[model samples]
Target: MPLQTVLVTGANRGLGLEFVRQYREAGWHVIATSRPLDEGVRARDCGAELLQLDVRDEGAIHALAHALEGRKIDLLINNAGYHPGAHQLGELDYSSWQTAFHINVIAPLQIAEAFLPVIPPGGKIVNIGSRQGSMACNREGGRYLYRATKAALHSITRSLAIDLTKRGIIVVALHPGWVKTDMGTDSADIEVEESVSGMREVIADLGQHNTGHLINYDGAVIPW
Candidate 1:
């Protein structure tokens, strides 16, 4: 296959940055978008196009859509996320919940919709997801907003799979495992490199049979 073009949101740091680095190293033309381009140099050095994007902004997303007109994206990683401290169930802030919805859920769907025409057959969409959002895996209840948002993401992935199937684009949700990124913290079992490598493995292994699935970084199926 020829070189793939990929876009990863939140590419300035953490798993997003690692994804940009690994994909670029693997010879993919990467469009790495982050809110602040000043912090995007590392991704740029890795052969990525550092793009200005705030997923919360519809205008920015639309602008990107226009800029990429005539371009075909082989893979799109909806990796940007936010977890506010006001995530406790009983003490939840309605504002934080809204913010979570905007970034963690709405943005992914909007991006997919805005760029739908550019994702050709055999293209892939990997929604960076979490086991924390899994109702089957939920052991605690404090992170209400974050959990709800990610669970919604899982739903979005499945729905997109159905909608994009006719177009021959494969859409699946991926749990990155507990990797040590800025979001995962130091105690997180896997390293950023390890998680990205694992996700790449999973992506490379995906086929028609795997579309609409919720999988871990190791390619294990995660219950809905």
Candidate 2:
């Protein structure tokens, strides 16, 4: 049988890079996307087919989809995110907030839309959402831009799950936790390996019934 193919966005470093490494190690065909040309090469070094993509660019997404038309995509992971500006209630840059929304929210949905035609039945889509996104789970709230955009991602995740159900596609929002990445920072609770491993397990077990759920890396269901 042919290896299952997974397409991951922003796969140059951090969680995205780890996803590529894990999947490749597990004998899957990985298609990794990054913005920089050197980063693309790094993805290639990690045993993935590299595609240069800036999630913010809709035309590039469409072009990639067109280029990969007829190819089977077993999984799509939208793992890119941008956290901008101060989280303080009123001390935010409006422009940075717009950028955060564009990168964190709109881009993932656009990428999903572009690739929908080629994803085979039983294909899965995992949006790398944040626990901060959960309105029900937000206790300390303040990271306005990041939080709002991730919340929007969860909303989109639910919609995609419902809309794609008839076609046998599973869509779910995944929170990787406060991982030790640049975004997560050095003070985070868990390492990249632990988080990615847990998420990989979650991905492996996903089915139609799991669609639309907000799942933590450790397989716990988070309130939406």
Candidate 3:
């Protein structure tokens, strides 16, 4: 049997890097993507094919899709994200917000759509989301841009799940816990390995039955 292939975006560090490492260790072929400046020596060392991809670049995405045309990708993880720092109640940079949405929401959807031809039936699409995106779970509010973008991502994930179900594609959103990374900060609760491991377990166990759900790394369903 051929090794399953997984393509992960933003795989230079943090959860994306860990996902690349774990999936490679599991005997899967991993295609790791990150921004042009991001040196992914770690990913290459893990035996992954490193692709320089700024998820926000439409032409680059299409180029990648064209380059890898007809290749069967078992999993596609949209893991690139941007958080323009903590925004106070009145202090919000509209420009940064737009960039955030472009990177966090629109890019993922576009990537998924562009890669559809390569993602065969039974392939999985995992969009990295956050509990901050949940309306039902939001009690304290700030960082409106990040929250809104992630919420949009969650909504898009649900729509993708519905649209792709007939094609046997499983689309789901996963909230990797607050991990200790550049985005998560050193004070964050979990390590990259722990969060990635839990998410890998969730991805491994996912099927048609698990499609369209917002799930935590530990396999718990989150309120949408």
Q: What is the C-alpha lDDT of each candidate?
A: 0.91, 0.93, 0.94
Q: Which stretches of model 3 miss by more than 4 angstroms?
A: none
lDDT of 1 by residue, 1-224 (tens): 78889999999999999999999889899999989999988999898999999999999999999999999999999999987777665777887778889999999999999988788899999999899889998877678888889999999999999988888899999999998877788999999998899999999999878999889998899998
Q: Write the per-residue lDDT of candidate 3 for residues 110-165, one digit (tens) a residue.
A: 99999999999999999999998999888997879988999999999999999999
Model 2, which residues run further than 4 Å from truth?
A: none
Highest lDDT against the true fold, candidate? 3
- The alpha-carbon lDDT assigned to residue 213 of candidate 2 equals 94
Q: Is candidate 1 or 3 superior in TM-score? A: 3
Model 3 error, position 144 (Å): 0.4
lDDT of 2 by residue, 1-224 (tens): 67899999999999999999999999999999999968677678989999899988899999999999989999999999987858887797778877888899999999999999989889999999999999999789688888899999999999999999999999999999899998999999999999999999999999998899999999999998
